[model samples]
Target: MNHEDAEMELTADSIITQRVIARPRPHRPVQAGGKVGAVPDAPLFLHLDAVTTILDSLAREEPVEAGGLLVGHSCTDSSGPYLLITQAIPATLARGERLCLTFTHEAWNQMLDRKQKEYSEELIVGWYHTHPGLGVFLSGRDLFIHQHFFTDAMQVALVIDPADFTWGLFYWQNDELVAANGYYIYGRSDQTYQALAELLTEYGVSWGIQTEEVDYNA
Candidate 1:
């Protein structure tokens, strides 16, 4: 059946599912980077501690692997190498089920409904899911679903590999998946720092942000 028919079916059901109506409200001004201010790329900065905390909480040996939507505003100007708006932690869910084609339609609708009630029409920044064992990257099917739903937009795909306490974020560009260079956000120790540094050097900009030591083992 088509998406329209699927919606009709869902509306008739009795389950209490959140509806994807619209973002509840416009994001209050934030200070990140993205084209919202004409910068070539959106500046994204994620707190490593925040990421670790979220992953830890979601993987506490509970059966319902945690998942949720990211909420934030767009940014334009910044002193650093990248621009970023900001995001807030609103609500979270213990994903009732794993993401797959079978559940994609329902999940999308539910997510949209939640957005409508919470953030108003803002786009999905990314999604987070706990990998009980699945590791930190999109499965082939997940990639296909992402392309189907988020074509031509800069949406983030975040996966948390709980066993190793590591995470992965994928940035989409022109239908091809590319590694999001984290040097601008995480500094030198980040795996992608050197790659981003090279890009900066080619652009005649200095990648002189003082590199901080990251004790991944900490």
Candidate 2:
């Protein structure tokens, strides 16, 4: 189906439920130099509002790296397990440099408090950060953070380059990290999805669903 059609279906069925399933353990061997090998079967779905929020936060922190934790729930459809990211909670106490970000203990405490108070039903599905002009790829430090904190297989890391609007998502698979070539953004209204598509297209990124099976060794 096309993007419009897919959005329509998702909007018609917007009730997202949380499911408790055994976390997929990392088993894929890490390649040399910590480079990601291939795209995993898991997919990520973001609400249109969540995307807008992330972009706005990134724009506000221009020239320096900015990041935040993602809030959402996981569910299994006929297609398989996927994440539905509904919120983007910016790191209020994060220290950001040109190439790195350090989330303080206060940041973690605040995030946990907010999750308990406001988003008790959602999980910290992943995180996102901007790279300024550095391009879209996970650094060694980024890999370390993901491995230690977000160890769950479904947890993902999103890297966005505000200068060029390029972005990528990385997830754990077979003990290795895999970059997602494509993802989905579900909206409750047609205008929302249209705006999202336009935004991604204007930034030179493909917003449509990926059709080709990811070749891991490529």
Of the candidates shown, which would achieve the greatest TM-score relative to the real structure? 2
lDDT of 2 at 63: 90
TM-score of each: 0.51, 0.71
* Per-residue alpha-carbon lDDT of candidate 2 for residues 42-94, written as tens digits (9 for 90 to 100): 55766756777787777563598888888787766544576777788887677
**lDDT per prediction?**
0.43, 0.64
Cα deviation at 182, candidate 1, in Å, is 2.2
Q: Which regions in candidate 2 have their CA more than 4 angstroms from the true location?
A: 1-18, 21-41, 189-196, 199-218
lDDT of 1 by residue, 3-112 (tens): 45335533322122223232221121121122222222334554333343354456455444455555433333323222221332322432344433233445546655
TM-score of 2: 0.71
Cand. 1 Cα-lDDT:
0.43
Worst 10 residues of 1 by lDDT: 25-34
